[model samples]
Target chain A: MHFSPILLHIPDGFLSTIVSLISWAITIAILSVAVKRTEKLDEKQVPLMGIMAAFIFAAQMINFPVAGGTSGHLLGGVLAAILLGPWAGMLVMTAVIGVQGLLLQDGGLLVMGANILNMGLLTAAIGFGLYKVGDGRKRTLKLGLAGLGAWLSVMAGALTTSLQLWLSGTARLDIVLPAMLGVHAVIGIGETLITVSALAFIFRTRPDLLDPAEGPARGGRGWIFVGAAISLFVLILSPLASSNPDGLERVAGDLGFLAQGKDAPFSILPDYTLPFLGEGAFSTIAAGIIGALVVAILVFFIIQSLRTAKKNA
Target chain B: MHSNIFDRYLHNNSSIHRLAPQVKVVIAILFIFSNALLPDGDWLSFAISWAVILLLNWLARLNLGYTLKRSLIVLPFTLAAITALFSVPGKTLTIWQIGSLELILTDAGLIRFLSIIVRSWLSVQIAILLVATTKFPDLIHALEHLRLPKMLVTVIAFLYRYMSVLTDEVIRLMRARQARSAVLPGRNGGGSLLWRARTAGNMVGQLFLRSYERSDRIYHAMLSRGYSGHLRTLNQHELNINDWLIIALAFLLIAFLQLFAHSIG
Candidate 1:
């Protein structure tokens, strides 16, 4: 597998324009609602949310090598969902994933929905479920289990994405499953470790920051706004994501769809580079930096706007 | 800096943002669902799809250059996937070699490839426009109102909030490495495998540590507030008449699009 785990790039032109647009629309709409609700929460919490969203985007950049010939990126949905709440987690993941599609093009615009469903919905939901069991009096045990669940679900998202590709007939099961699952399994261990560590850190550092009993903690609908603001910045570093093909690519190669990969005409941005704009890794690095800058600026303003709203309210 | 993306996207600034997330979600779902089922070769249907998207894009006022630039990441994946069509053993339109296997561009292969491209471009553009127009926070708020599972919504919200925090930490580490002689002399980075691998590991460790601390702080706050798992809040989400109109319009459009696809097929 040639996949670089730090980045899970879902290529464009895989899904049609309609799919991409609809996904964008849906995500934006949902994110907006999330923001509005989050705005209504403890106003002070907004900045904190911004910083946390940045953390997720940052974590996504770290790649771990896998068992086979590939690697897997961190599917941090479980970690986020467990800490924030599943709904909040999903919205944040979608925002990050959305910016990846729009700004960095880490994932295809068309399949944005599928991408969100995989990384956002699955990881967060599963992580949340697992975290719930562990969040009891035995928080240490809860944290441990939550870590395991988070790791498994990240792989589950990868598996689900693989299945979606295979089901769509663009990929073969035998090759994709082994290629994806194999590498992801190894990657999953790292995810588990990271989740456990993160959980431990949170539990140990400021356990009171996340107690469910807090009034604003319960009614912090305003956090939704903060989370959405964070999503923009979450993708600031997507251009830095590993350019290697993911699990699906290996599977596609082994199972036969590998040959289908080809360049497109009328495509303004090809090869993930601006084309004719410097060569080699420099352009890629430059793009990543610029992309990150763009995302960061966008998010800053978004947060600012939300802050204004809170003040006005 | 590129506020142009959003400025142009939300040409309508009155109340579209206040609509429920579910309506938009349902509309997007219906559109994509029918799109997937549509015949691959239906030029008319494709045209209709294109028309709808283009119209939406235009209405959103997105800068074509920015939108396209942002959309570039889709290329490699699309090309890679379409490249597979060349080897499906169908009627050969063109044949060549890239590395080892003979890459064949068959008619069926070509159609599959083209569909994938179209799908990628169109879908991404629309999605981008959607985000450009609607604010992100409002979108999630809408989802909560729509009866989307609270836990799921909360998870997504957190991921959105914290993803960037950790990434910056990675960059700082990268910068620290750059400060230490770096790889490319003045550039502060190298192409060495060992260096890259070490950096990746260290970065991962740091990310885990930072995120761990943040989650802990948030958890304690939750507990301090008397949270027993159920994230309770009284924020009510309402779908206004405009929202209903949007949903109805979406249904009508999808219905027509599906009908058009079937007739053409």
Candidate 2:
């Protein structure tokens, strides 16, 4: 009857009906989108996806020695995201979580929705997002990012769990939140190393398995070129600029200006007017709108190109 | 591979087992929700709920001792809830100065902690009852009927079916590792921590490749037989008037008991 501390599966009565119901609503919304998208997958991927779910389940059974004589198992959100795409990976995690709750009694049935959201949807989404942080070509970079992604995914899950417990009045946020984060930060290191090693091994052996949904690596060069061009333009033309005196100054001072700076306060400039016209809230909004539009357009083209690339492949 | 750990489904011809899987799932959720919604420290409600759960267990023909033993799985969760005993601020019943910090236990905290434990125990008991009486696949079919995403259900079905196979594969891999390396008989028997981890990582990589290739072959085989994306099977669910009556009677009783407990408490 002893359960490992590393499991983090919330049992019943920990969450109120309101929290559980809201979680179920959000989980169902995401899962419905996942189902709709995956429905368009090739029929050949049917067995592959199923077997991948089994692989995750089996992988979890293998326990590795963590710090202090205790053992821990893989959550496999990042692994699934790397092997499959995020959508499919989320589905696989959902299935794994569901089966664990239903059969193994690892989690409570009432709280299954929250568990899935924390361990499945959020982890897969965040991990996949971090995995895509680096370019897909370099082996070392991909593996490194995968490790980071895996580590962050665990922390994110832990954070979400603590927040949910706090919201449910199960525990005080001041006590449980710090405790959960501190414990999970160390646990996340083990996750990172395991994920890195596994990904490196797979990349060395069969890189084809690493991003199945990404299809072939066509137009990547073109996309990089486009990205560089956009970056150059943004760097030169951006009005939000504050140069740091030195590395020491930047470290001692705020890092807020490292990205976009604070917008102007007043509405002297119209929203469409460039920042050069006036230094007001309207210009800041205009600048923000312009930046968002550019990014959206770029993402749209990248996706379109990837779809065509997949067709070619 | 320890497939025997599974097959918890008890073969019984009781009326509880005869109810549709969807009905049973709904009833289980309702029971858990009702138990959870009850006011903390309402021992009357808790007692009534336990009595009803025990009744259902009897109707299902499950062993009382086994059911009680199985319900002990909620113990770990109770430990987590126990933290509230010290952390929750209220009327201090006891306080101990340990080193630099003071650990205080309040009456309200104790009540909340105990309530959480009892509620969880009761909820898990109902869950165990549902899973113990219904077949696994039937339960999954019931989920499908409940409109869980198809992709999720499909993955669950395959994961459940192939988990044992993959576990067997893992056992073989471990056996191979053990045969090659022998050290002490206790923990960390065969290798250092990093070595064991590396071997595990390799095994995982190997398993992924194997499962991947197997999936490809399976897909090809299925395709040769005109396989498509959708999974179709014969529908065997049929609900009778007895099922409806049982479900309705159970809900009505639960409602009445809850209302009575609320009014009295």
Candidate 3:
């Protein structure tokens, strides 16, 4: 019923040192890129970005009761990305999370890197990637994509948080992953509703703000493609990281990939193996990379064919 | 509007308040890191860390009770670690059968869970002290001096400056909504859940528009005052011998605690 204000912020000592440090490395690298990208911003837009950060910080304080006494609030990552572009959105989210950690103690300083990565970087990337798909599209379609992006960003955040906890040995992957996803699945709907409604309001009122040219530096669609690739890579690797086979097997069964008691017809990465590396963590990671790469290339070709067909038509 | 409720900075002229912001920032971070790195169930090391924190609190002229109470904010989140009680493998302390499932509380799990609580509490105490002792602007300056990206630092500065203003705006919006939506004694106040969420979303959208317009006006005002892209602060803090001595002492204490934690294991 009573929701902790900063529920998603991973506090200190929850994450293992290795996971924390690795998250820090990834966050620092991405933030450096974000900083460089937003470096050429117009002098006027700087204040806008700052106030937007404040707006997000303030927006998160607003909670709408979901069911029972429980409530859910806007995370504002996707909303920010839609208003500002991804780079600026990430910067705004970072500043908000930073203040939440340093001043509010909502998240830990040591694991602040992981918190920022999970809640800010990944959310912004996923949210913006999906939302940008609707660029110049019909109004309803754009709103639909924004809602979907908002929902998925929450899921991505929950997924990464589960992975971090699992990797840190704080919780078993089999238990934490499904539990987190299930709860966030509901919370994410709230995110979707709020983001879509808010975006709809903006669209109706000041349509100029939604225009990419008038916004902060627009991230190229190339960022979307790269984000998609990275997400696919992580998703492919996740199941292998879980020690329990039933988790993946059950998923396979539900997806109709595993028939009754039959073995899968074929295993591209059988037992997550590589011929050169044999069976170990490294082999599993290598196989995941190969699988992700194969899927990405296939999708690329399909899109390429569709584009060419449209041109010919 | 009681906007400063979120800003816990207490006006005091203690030595900790006068210490270099960067020095305090570095020490707080190092202290937290040392605490986090301690092995689970290392009560001795945790005790020593608490002692150090208490001593610092005394020096800062802060009410120990106030800081401890503030640090209790971490308690609810400790629920996230509850699953560790059953999911972790160890010697079973207790076992309960619920329907088709067996929930086992392991000794190792209990130790780890308690350690997480203590570690978070200790770290949060340090954070509360840091924020309470240092001004927000000075904190931002410290971050900039530490070589954080200028643009990011500037945004953080703006965020701190405008946080209260936006917070007041949000409070006003909520008050308006509450006034319109009246509840019976036993039932809900607002419309259907979807409507309520939409209303909140609309409020958010309204807030965004206001914030965007305010930023424009703020920029124009700055420009009128001959504002440049760069922000110059009045205070230029150079680390004095006392600040260096404190840093050295903090480093040694943290190193010693870490060494003690490792030695025990």
Candidate 4:
């Protein structure tokens, strides 16, 4: 029922050490190829790369609300892939997740690979496939397709994460699949709007930059209406998001993790609930709003630092 | 750029830090996998996992204090996941209640929770250690050798390269916001929530626009440099006896933990 601003993903217990390590290894392997691949690029691209990566990191902090008290952030993998090539986009998304894990504590280091695969590669690759399917034709249609791709990928990522939990034997199949699919069905709408709107704007103003593989094409605002209408749908329908336990909870209950998932010892607040902020509908909304702002600020700092570095370099 | 930050975690001179990147990469993954898989109830297995990671930390000569700070971020999620148990009431698990929500913090539950926390802490630390020790490039190089999809690996590398630059654009947008409105402590009249909201909207728009432009530049750059979308990396030297020994030992330890956890669970 609460909107966790800083997404509390992949609770430590759900993943085994081996799972964590293997994923970490996978993350590194991918990252290295990214660097090697980029070695031949101009010095100019390096600074640009840093900036885009910062943008992805910052984007996560700015979340939009949906029904069911659940809000989602910009899963940058798809968008990044569209802008940068899939590899670069994936790396940038990973960097965002990496910094969030290491410095911000937004995601877990143990589950870094999962985070990357989910948010970065899955969304980007899937979205690219869908975008190609639409053939980058009209603006409204292209943007619409982009939004659908974005939304689907977010849900896809969530579903995959749930599967990982199941594979780890931390949760049961019966619980993880249905529950994860449900919440994400709503979350995907929010994702669709944000991603589609952003892409639409870019497609209209600077169609040249969109889809590294495709050339400039007509972009339009009708798609914006589609995106807005979807947002409106979310605005109207989000309140109905099931109060049933999320995928993690469902699995935890059936598997053994439900009992094991505990709060950290050092947090000022016992749960995500703030002491001053009483737990209620009003409080949840307030927290969600505040959480969005907080992410905005954190993202601002990360981007700011990157800009300074660019200048100095 | 901020490539240094990528290198910042690695490039240390300690023996643990100097160990083969591939070996460390493999070991770190196994360590985390085992940590996640180990049953919740066993105290000894958790202790041993912790002990092993701590030993590695000591050998790596990591900045324990600084690393502790880094690990603090994941702490909250770990705490929150267990929140429901404290609220769902029953005669079963250990009992606790928050308002109407009854929780079962049973002895078994508490033990299970502890194992999760310990496992997360250890696994994350090991990751930090891997980055903290191995140069970012070498880690990726090891991965390339390990048969990762090159396309995906290339994506990660690019993000690391460019994320910082975009961060600056965001800062400038925010600073411009504070400049027009009041941001200083004494003059804090203009920085109300509404104003901040307006600024946030503008910033997101601006960010999207700027990112779009940057992509244009990057695309041209990619073509100019003859990026055929295929990244070919120079493979590192093969793993040696030490690497095999490390991998073997890591697997053995993981196996041992699994057996121990089963016996206790």
Order of candidate numbers by TM-score, starting with the best: 3, 2, 4, 1
C-alpha displacement of A238 in model 2, angstroms? 32
Residue B112 of model 2, lDDT score: 79
CA lDDT, candidate 4, residue B79? 36
In terms of docking quality, model 1 is incorrect
Docking class of 2: acceptable
Put down candidate 1 lDDT per residue, B11-62, tens digits, no spaces: 4553433446567556655665566667666767877887886666565555
State residue B136's C-alpha deviation in candidate 4, in Å: 1.0
lDDT of 3 at B256: 84
**What interface root-mean-square deviation (Å) does model 3 yield?**
5.9
lDDT of 4 by residue, B1-265 (tens): 3434324473457888767878887787777767777776566887888777778778888767767776665575553335323322233655555454444565654554566677777777777777788766676667667786554345446655554566556556656765776446765354433223333434565697777577667777777888665545575558888879878988987898788788767
Better of 3 and 4 by TM-score: 3
Clashing pairs in 3: none
Residue B19 in model 3: shift from native, Å? 0.6
Cα lDDT, model 2, residue A18? 85
Models ranked on DockQ: 3, 2, 4, 1
Off by over 4 Å in 1: A1-54, A62-163, A172-313, B1-22, B87-90, B97-103, B162-170, B181-200, B215-237
How do the residues B1-265 of candidate 3 rate in per-residue lDDT, one tens digit apiece? 6666568898999999999999999999998888879998999999999998899899999998899899888887776777667655578899876544456788887887888889888988999999999998999999999999988999998998898899989989988998998889998577667678778888999999999999999999989998787578999988889888999998998898798799978
TM-score of 2: 0.80
